[model samples]
Target: MIIARILILLPLVSANKPQFPLGIAVYANPEFDICHRDMRAVMETRDLKFFNSVIDKTRIYSWPLKNFKSDIESLHNSPLFQLVRKMPKGAALHIHHKAMVNTDWLYLQTYRTNLYVCDKHNHLSLKFFKTPSNDCNWQALYERRRNPLVRQVLEDRIRRQMTMLTEIPDRSDTNVLWEKFQNIFTFLRSFLNYRPLAEDHFYQGLLELYEDNVMYVEVRSGLQKLYDLDGKIYTTTETVNILHDVVTRFKADHPDFIGAKIIYAKSRDMDHDELRSFLHETVELKKMFPGFIAGADLVGHEDAGYKLKDHSSLLLEVSNWTDFFFHAGETQNFLLQPTNLQIAIRHNAKRIGHAYSITKEPDTLRELKEKNIPVEVCPISNQVLGLVSNLRNHQAAILFALDIPVVISNDDPGLWGAKGLSDDFYMTLMSILPMNANLYSLKKIARNSIIYSTLSENEKAAALDSYEKRWQQFLINVTMPFCDYTQVMYSWLTLDRNTW
Candidate 1:
């Protein structure tokens, strides 16, 4: 392996390197795993760069693909993408398996081969496919293009197909996005669950995410359906088995997935004890699959009055091996939002999923900063939730600017109707947060993701080196080749730092 040794030794020997730190989207929820045409379409909107200082700047390294024209040219005539493919990215911190994964693949697994999709009007719905017939199909969902309400339903279902090409304004400022967000889940759960849909969705979603350059995804999902009795009841074990099976099969397929972690979440509208039991059972079940299972969380409308503080005793009682990841400060409706952050940290949370309001409390902000905690900044989620109407003032800038380990993610890319991580990064880089867009800065963001992730130290180191080698080689070739960025923009390269 002389070649391998030299490859590792290469970067260390270079000085004044044009090398870029490895970068990645970290996480693209199955809910938000839209493909290529959809990704290009999303980046074309007027508001795409409506918030970034670099709105007029030539696209480069991190989000070049957002500029299909330039990227396509580079793809054919330049080596930027070749370099990009070599860059290493760490783990994707946020994901919702059910919503993030593609449902079509799931449909196929459970013997759902037929079609019940509405045409002309544009809508799709699957019902008892096996009982009826998979062979005699009326029309696939793809062919049917239903009307208004139906279109809205279909669009919502496929929102992860890509970020919406046009902006859809926030419906109500006061209604927390978390409130409206869960409806997507309830809607999907209410509609699909007959066959082993989780497996289909998980695989497809992972494939979509991998295509977007996301290696590891920590999926946060509400509990899989425990039962669907016609006014009948089934033990929670049935649901657990279904979830376990999905993970088992998924792991069999995607080894680099970094694995899926169950959120063991529940809607706050349910009985608290019922939720508690699920949490406890999930912790107990972790014995069956150690590293793959992450821990528990409580989501749904935050105003529903079931605070993490309420579960403090249970949380303290649980072993540290079973981590706690909370969705805190997602609400403007309650002052208790900050308190949730406090409890999350005090209880030793692995990370805060969407602590948007944590900055409002000066002391808590200091604590978070000092602790080196990461804020899972989901810009689209915040916009959709109406906590912040524009990316211009998204709190991610505050956390990131100050060097708080912050990682950008597509919280529910599917539901937000967006593609994978890069599009989100492009939107944020070009429009909103004026964070530095150079190679080192982008790599640091990627490192923060890995450093702050729940992955073990060995895993993080391995991922980090893997990313470094890839990026270095890509960049090295750029300098040696005829059309590298440095040579092509020799004039700009020597310009004052302020010109950037």
Candidate 2:
């Protein structure tokens, strides 16, 4: 009789245990639970197939273990990726403005007339001119693309230069990778600096995010001055107005779109006075465009640049004027004293970008949890930039395990041919989170993006309400009798077979 009582109590004890990683309120809903089970089964089957594949066997332990550039095409063909593409991702809080749209769209812009391209030591730079001048061997791209053979070869070369895609992603030297990465931005700056093209670029970027089911975004933009075809330069305010116009037009076309905000980002490589001037300008812009300018951030590779604490007084002073979404702890060097993570927390950063090394600092992690500061985790960016070899070993997995607030973002999706937040979200679900993580995990993460966003409380509430409704509809769609998972898989394969 005692043994029987113990067995019955054992089941009760198991039931009382908390869910791993974290628990979600929606876990109690029967419909949601059923949907989650179905989704989990699909995810597990994909994992099994991926792990048993011949390529996976020779290369890495798992699918995400491979370089993102090499694996991105295959991921696009995945049924799981398709499902993620259809889900309502709450917000993209850490995307770079210039790198938001894919290179394919940028390549199409080269077809415009009077566009000049200068090739120097195998590096390409583009600019617009009313009349061609002998500036750095400026050749008319219009004439270059006139030949079918030349157009094909030149397009391929330009696309390759514009992206970071490589079969052998450099793993040994991060400095080399960063050098190449920064160079791509430099090459793009000339091409995108044209006012008309900039407007189109911003609009296309929003469309890409919207099509990927991301409702809102906070773009980390440099707010650089733009020039017209006749070399008429527009002031910073003019540029901001242009961007605002693009967002307004986009939202009008897509009524469901919640719109975008700019986190005016300046490079950390600036001197003390330069940053102070930039901060003052940022404050003035925030005043000018109250609803559009969300905050300020210093973006660049952390280790090589001045630390956040280096400009403490200026940052502290500006903290009263505007909020901060500082990029901190992106480095792999943990032994550095008063790390960026600690400094960012000290400065009361609203959101931490790429806190990849946060796991190494227990005290800092505790402080982040206590302060409820969310870390904008970019999984594929970290992997591609040589911060971590495999997503399974990424520090974000630790953050998830500890229940620390995390918002998955795409730092520079366009640079790698990724469209939106879906790629990063897919990586988080497949590799960062535990295999047992269910739909509740995804829901909670999506919700957190809104909660920790720069949106006002009222705006956040409305966004969450909208998100909840859409999420429920998604659940219903996936669970309906006519929604055959096998058919979806086969269809994706057929559609993407050409690329494969």
Candidate 3:
């Protein structure tokens, strides 16, 4: 009797079953460049490659622009298109605030509407800075930059600088590429700090995610430092208040869009005392509103020279009280220890942001597998950071194989130069994981977004039910002639439609 019961229960535990949910995406912040979700001009151009780059083998269509018309009718009838149409991502659990707004939205904030950022000798500083000049279209930029094709040169530089991930990973001659990424963010920082500007960016980014099928966003925002339009240096608490207002307003405007669970972030440069103050702010946020501020994150270059263990005490304190949604093991080279993972396991982490280095420790990997902890996988960010040069070598691929759940995210889609959840999905499909991954597997991955999200159980169940219904309806609509669930036709006549 015991052996028979165990045999029956084995199927639930031993094997992987598909539980895919399709919901629209919701970004943590609205301003950041989130690739396939939101793109302007340059980032826009990369969408086709980003979206089609993955799952293209199974995709019935040739190019995204060519749409379905370029392919054979039979191609459109595949399970691939069905997955694409029906797949609904739950939420962007880990997006950065700077990425919530596009470079274009930031440009619009400034009086000089044209995005003519000049790069002389590969050192890019704002050209129209300190002056509100309206004669700052691409034409004026071309004349100032001197190359007859100055606008094109500047645009190419902007495009190249904006898209640092597309470049080849050459650690040898790294001066140009490394500086370019920081400079781009620095330029972005100058624009996003103004309260009004930040609000606009935040709103737009969430809208973008909503269009791409993301339901909720738990975005990371830097509160340790502020640099931009604001003269006074507001404390972390003040920053959270501003962010709360922004998200609240945005959510009010769009009833369909579920807003942010502010993941208040601290940089590695912060001292131990500063870290405590940051956590205090997070605790206060929890007191303010249950759903408004979700948790805390350790953003920035953790490998820049601080061990996560340096702040272990404070981390433990936060874990003792509040939940921690950490950016652990993001570095490909510098961070050598797995202390953060242990911390998360001990504390009972909500979800790990970018647990890329878990493969290095065999024992820790076991702990994670046993805990069933989900890792927030950011493919483009890792690629740009040179952790996994391509998606083929992504750590998330291994984690997924172990049946450890992972939710795909665009860490800084604008900074990385891609759009929407589709970009990350595309990369995971083609370069990382399995090239021949079926619709069922892809849908399961999409569903993991909701599973790993901070959403309540009831909300998740409703969303999952909606997704299943959507899939069933799509199947019926697409394969109407073939689908015979009752088998009325088959029972009445001799037929052979047993195989799909």
Measured by TM-score, the strongest candidate is 2
> In lDDT terms, which candidate is top?
2
Better of 1 and 2 by TM-score: 2
What's the best-to-worst order under lDDT? 2, 3, 1
Put down candidate 2 lDDT per residue, 25-142, tens digits, no spaces: 2233322232333433432322334434322433433567777887677777655566678788999999998999898888889888779988889888898888766768888998
Q: Which candidate, 1 or 2, would have the higher lDDT against the true structure?
A: 2
Q: List the residue pairs that clash in candidate 2.
A: none
| C-alpha TM-scores of all predictions | 0.67, 0.87, 0.69
Better of 2 and 3 by lDDT: 2
How much is the lDDT of residue 12 in candidate 3?
Answer: 18
Q: For each candidate in the order shown, give its overall lDDT on alpha carbons.
A: 0.54, 0.79, 0.57
Better of 1 and 3 by lDDT: 3
RMSD of each: 11.1, 8.6, 12.2
Clashes per candidate, residues 3 or more apart or on different chains: 33, 0, 33
Which stretches in model 2 have alpha-carbon errors above 4 Å? 1-20, 23-26, 31-61, 133-135, 147-153, 482-500
- Those runs of model 1 whose alpha carbons end farther than 4 Å from true positions after fitting are 1-88, 102-126, 129-167, 170-180, 226-257, 319-321, 431-435, 473-500
